[model samples]
Target chain A: MAAPAILITAFVVIGGMATALAQSLGLFPLVGPPSLTVAAYAAQASDLPVGIGLSLAIAAASTVVACLVGFTAALVIVQGRWCGKLVAALGTLTVPVPHIVGAASVSLLLADSGLLARLFNAGGSWPELVGGPWWIGVVAEYGWKESAFVALVVTGTLATRAVSYDETAALLGAGRLSRLRHVLLPLSLPTLTVSATIIFVYSLGSYEVAWLLGRAYPEPLPVMALRLFNAATLTARPEAAAVAIVTTLLSFGAVAAALAYLRRSTLWR
Target chain B: MIPAVRVEGLSKSFPGTGAPVLDDVNLTVEARSCTALLGPSGAGKSTLLRAISGLERPDAGRVLVGGQDMAGVGPEHRGMAMVQQRPLLFPHLNVLDNVAFAGTVRGVAKRAARADAAGFLELVQLAGFGPRPVAALSGGQAQRVAIARALAARPAVLLLDEPFSALDPELRSVMHDLLAQLRRSVNPTVLMVTHDRSEAAAVAEKIALFSGGRMLQHDSVERMYSRPVSLEASRLMGGANEIPGTVRNGCHHSALGALRLPGDTTWPPGPGILLVRQESIEVGPGNGPGLHATVSGLRVLGPRRLVSVDAAGVLLRAEIPWGRALAAGDTVTLSIPTSALAVVDDPDTAHTFPGAEKRPQITVQGLATLASIDN
Candidate 1:
């Protein structure tokens, strides 16, 4: 019974990737006869390096921020008080808001003439957060949104798995900081890694947030791919597929690394 | 010297649970002495231990360690360590690191802490097992490691919350022996909680009895067995026979006829319950100047047989040696010395038995039979 569903999912995922690979290799084209060449990849090689680096930097920044904030939020949520409930409610509220909506809100709220700049009356000295060289707006949007996802997932693991050992550590004379370092971090490492991987991959491949918030000069992989895919030149389509393929490969590499690290963790075992 | 541990009027109740988990409990343990909180499950024994360890805050009263108040002290600062029922060893640490955790957390050098931990492992008979991961341990080995870990802290008070209840019978006995060795070598003031009466009596110099969130009695192990203060306490302490009667003129009058109360008893003239330890009641075939009864049931428990007898409709069970073969329907005379009797009054029936209510003649053989199932 499960075989059919598994097969269908495999076909959809693998078939889509195969089609993209074919297009990137110049074996399939929308406006010309089929042929094979590395022209599409070699054409964007210079831009490809910049795009991959930008995408990696953004995803790395977002994942680190999300994990740290989410881990702290998870600790608070597991404490089980009014404050915990408030944090939990806020996380729950954040998770369902679409990232596109989140990006729009972030752009509006952090732009030079946006809400905070107007409210604070500091329009002239505003930080240039949106459409800035630092890509601060894109990273912040991903961090804020994905932290809630990470928090909820990690809180579930901590509430059930870490509590008993946490108490045991306390009884063993581990103070607050020591308990956090020894018990909470080790116990929650696998969950944290898994959630962080999801956030990283999502940030790497998502285009709408970066496109809406990032400066046009050195775009992230997803934004550059979408731009090329929609350009007037038909030859740009293969370049777009090449960028997408690189993004997918990077995600798969990240997931494989995370799984390798988790497999060696004593707690994960 | 001040007691090593003192709990004064500690009370705790969970929100929305009207019945308190602990109610007006007070207890003390002398320096370097062991005390057991013996009671049924949910009797608040473990809760009291947690309160003393500072893992739990009581709604009323407080805990003192070595005559110092423990209010606002966290478990980490309490100079106390606890071994939970399931041997909750740190999964990320190997056995040596787990046992060395307390010292390492206190800034002891890792090598020094581990060397000290190896000695503790030896004390618990797990010396060579230090390199093994906690997950690789057997149930008994894991518990031994937990005990070693707690002891490596060199705590002022060691709290054990049914630490051996989860192990098999043979492993539990081994743990008990290790505990005895620890008491002799370390001699730390210890407070342990257990529902098994024998476990408490074997490990603790003093035993406190609790039921329904209230402490019923605290006494030495010998006195707790021979002189429980209430019928509830008597049953908890493993006494099987309860003869409902009234006390007047220092004599208890029941279906078995008037009997003299123990000289130490100071109960006033009132309806009372007479409790007799089955081990204290003697049964023989020869006639005697005691209650003449007939055996209604017999059970073999190792080298002893639990003989149930009915003396003029007052049912009683006696533990007798298995030398002479006894069977159901056999006639025997049962004698219980006045020194072996403990009479306690029921609060509701303090004044009367309600319109000349006759003593119920139901056999307590079922109670003895149920008690046997625990073994």
Candidate 2:
């Protein structure tokens, strides 16, 4: 690679690590006195388990749902005529939006006073269009967004994969569903994992969605940290910094572990 | 038993393509017979093979597995297996899962699928490779695994789209032997598409030549090569020496000299082109019972030699044995035997086909298999 590209990449990596370290050290002057201390760590440690649990539920559920839907969409597009074109046309529209934008859009569309409700009201419908607590939105958003992302990813990844296997599997007496379940799904899994993990990590650190559409109480990790930083006392800033560090570290850990597991699993070999 | 397959008027126009790649292609592949689709690069051989496997939808036509029309049958419903030119094994699956893929998808228990898949692995001569990663396989081994995977489903029809084109000649020959074994033992009907006439001739019981969006001819391998119905079929089958001749008194007089066609007595004297296979011309000395010619150059094809000679005024290529080496200036007698000539109305050639009078001193060697003769 050219020096500029390498330098740019290195700078991004260093910049991310530096910011993570600064946050962990409570260096921000706006909310608290800047210092490296173990007090923040101690205070946040009490809340870590719940936060981690919430993160896992959201991330894992989203990854699995996204992969199933995405891999299936990829198989259909690659194996089907009209459906493939339609999938291609609807690709990647929702994934790359800035976190704040994504969070706001989902909130506007699914919140009680949102467009969905307005549409329901216009129809004189009684049942709320999108209801329930954070769990519902967590599952619903991840399911909706990640599937499309996975679909796009799988399509690109499997472009070189042969259409002939469909034929061969058929010639071998495989029925339509069986061929997909047997030949197509298994074949697309490696790429499925890669794409799922990418969206998983995206979900892991995602703050905007949780802030906009997530429940106000029993706050998500990002929201919890945000509330701590906003406290009047300077003492709470270190604790908030500590929570941010832990959340960032958890995201890194999940991605790194998935990468390692993928390497050892013969998926890439 | 029902014939292995029957196809009629198969035609496909790719989305956005103005011309149909495959048009009105009719065929019957009998049970356990090996049939080859032969044509040049753009002759729609691949499209035809894909259509049979139900991988590609034809704009018009019918594909019958037995007596049933399979117009809307998807590939997975066709009970057929296909091998593409490049081996496209699932990178995510190990050899065991890759070969057993279809069976498992059909709800075969994993253990049973793996076991039956192992049997096919043995059939393709890769018995112990069940655990190997796809990337770890050699080119030849990967191709064999693809075959194993396809055959494991036990589909009655097997389609190969230039599958062996990437293999070295030696490996291709090995594949041929393996296919012959399948014909005898497994007894699957085979339909293969190839640009290589030599490979088609070697393995196929029947050959169908396609050109200009139509099947020029489909017949036994020998008949297709020796008695190609048109100039296109002849050209695709390695008849590079062509000459425009005038039919006079039921005898065609050409730049390659004169010859008689039994079927030409009814045609009025006008213009026609004579196609001569390279092997038809025997090169010797003197104008004794042949077209007068001179040695131009020669190419040595492994066991045989192709002697380039000038017959009359036209440059033509003829295959000769490697036993003797002729220099560039030697006077050579070129024979234009009646059986060696195919005449057609000169179509689209206006340079008076120097092919008749313009002799380029060139010889082709190494490609000297006569398997295409005597259908």
All candidates: interface RMSD: 1.0, 2.8
**For residues A99-202, what per-residue lDDT tens digits would candidate 1 score against the true structure?**
99999999889999899999999958999899988989998999999999999999998898677788888888899999999889888888999999999999
The deviation in Å at residue B67 for candidate 2 is 3.3
lDDT of 1 by residue, B152-173 (tens): 9888788999999989988888
Question: After TM-score superposition, what is the CA distance of residue B321 in candidate 1 from its true location, in Å?
Answer: 3.8
Place model 1 in a CAPRI quality band: medium
Error of 1 at A133 (Å): 1.1
Off-target runs (Cα >4 Å) in candidate 2 are A1-38, A41-48, A62-90, A122-132, A138-148, A162-168, B240-276, B285-293, B296-302, B308-316, B334-375
Query: TM-score for each prediction?
Result: 0.93, 0.83
lDDT of 2 at B370: 12
DockQ, structure candidate 2: 0.51
